[model samples]
Target: MSTLANETYEARVVAASEPGVTFSGALSSEWIKFRTLRSSWAVLLAAVVALVAIAGLIGYVTGSKWDGQLDPEDRVASAPLQGLFLAQLLIGVLGVLFVSGEYTTGMIRSTLAAVPRRLPVLWAKGVVYGLVTLSTLIPTTFLAYGVAQLFLSHFGHSTSLSAPTAFRAVLATGIYLALVGLLGSALGWIVRSTPGGISLLVGLLLIVPVLLEVVPGQWAKDISHYLPSAAGASFYSSLQADGALSPGAGLLVLVIWVAVATTVAAFLLKRRDG
Candidate 1:
């Protein structure tokens, strides 16, 4: 009886000594997985390069058009941001892979086995990758802005970052991309396939806008401005796009879009298999 009691106490101590699962641990795990993946870093680098490179190219062309003549008021609308459409494609796809790639490699089963509750894994992926996306994209956006303005400065056509519209356009562009990255991550949870998520993202951002333009109705015209792409664009530069919402309204619309996508994904995640 004494031996049995000693063994029981030993087993209890061992069990207590083992660490239990926690949300913070899950977050750390997801971060490690993200940083270790070559594709994640590669996509991030590609986004940085694409945005900065394209902005510089557009800036050079815009400046060169004036043949070295200065025009203080002839500035283009957010020329530094011209490259973000392409960056969106790259970053959005990476967000999709944040979830889908695990399933493809069968690692999700193990992840689920560890975090049986499941939704925390989904939330962690979005939060970690979203934060990573925001941190990287914001600085990169500013860098691209400076690079573009350098080219514009050569022709004395550069707009000041302190200018009211210029600050909003640049900062809003960064936030817009961060939300787009979240949108892509949410799509990954909903579809659970990288290709499918990518297709949906492209359809929503690129194809829908084109289709809306041809629908030939006031409703379509108004609704198009609320879609993720146009809404995000308006948040940065309502002055540039026709039928754009005010910056505040456009940002609100975009937040709704992202929130809805994530909620749908969460509902499906709770109901479906890993």
Candidate 2:
């Protein structure tokens, strides 16, 4: 056999001889995979830039156009978070591709070969990606907040982070976005197909909210407010629009959503051959 085949055999034999896949080992392996991938870094960087730059642009436009008409709390609360609309899609799709790409390339077999128990692989992926996302975006959230505030500050409408609600909006911006990406990651595991996963995530985050508009009832309105994007806005949105959830309830809604999706994906992963 060729050298490549011999190395593959040796690796498999080592994996087979091991007592079990340690969670820490799985996490380290996943971290290597996620960090080394150029696409992961590229997408993450793009998300950060989108959040910060677009925030500045929006701030500039609003500050220039509205002059002093914009409310201080409203300006700081909502304007900075405007970038999440695009940034969420970027990170969410990145979440999907992080898993489904391995499947697409037939690398999942090798991954599972290294971790026969399977669940650790999924757990490690989610944990690693989620931490990376959360860490990166928390600072990005602040940067976005600062950039937008720079513009609004000139117009005397910007609020400090120390303001009662400003920190909630800023912190929730990152937490909300991190959950969106986690949701996409879970969907990736569930779907296991790139296109299907992407479609499902987009449909859930974007299309579903719009579709609810035509449902025509108090129930529809009620459910609409609970949907991922709207729920996210409740905490991150300084305006606190009518019908939106409270900040705490919004966080719970998103956490529950992520938990459900991840649990379902874990169950399906354990049962399916793929």
Best by lDDT: 2
**Local accuracy by lDDT, each model:** 0.86, 0.88
CA RMSD of each candidate after superposition: 3.8, 3.9
Candidate 2 deviant stretches above 4 angstroms: 1-20, 68-76
lDDT of 1 by residue, 29-98 (tens): 9999999999999999999999899889878878888655645433545656778989989888998888
List residue ranges in candidate 1 displaced over 4 A. Answer: 1-14, 67-74, 238-240
- Tens digits of per-residue lDDT for model 2 on 235-273? 787777787899889899999999999999999999999
Q: Provide TM-scores for the models.
A: 0.91, 0.90
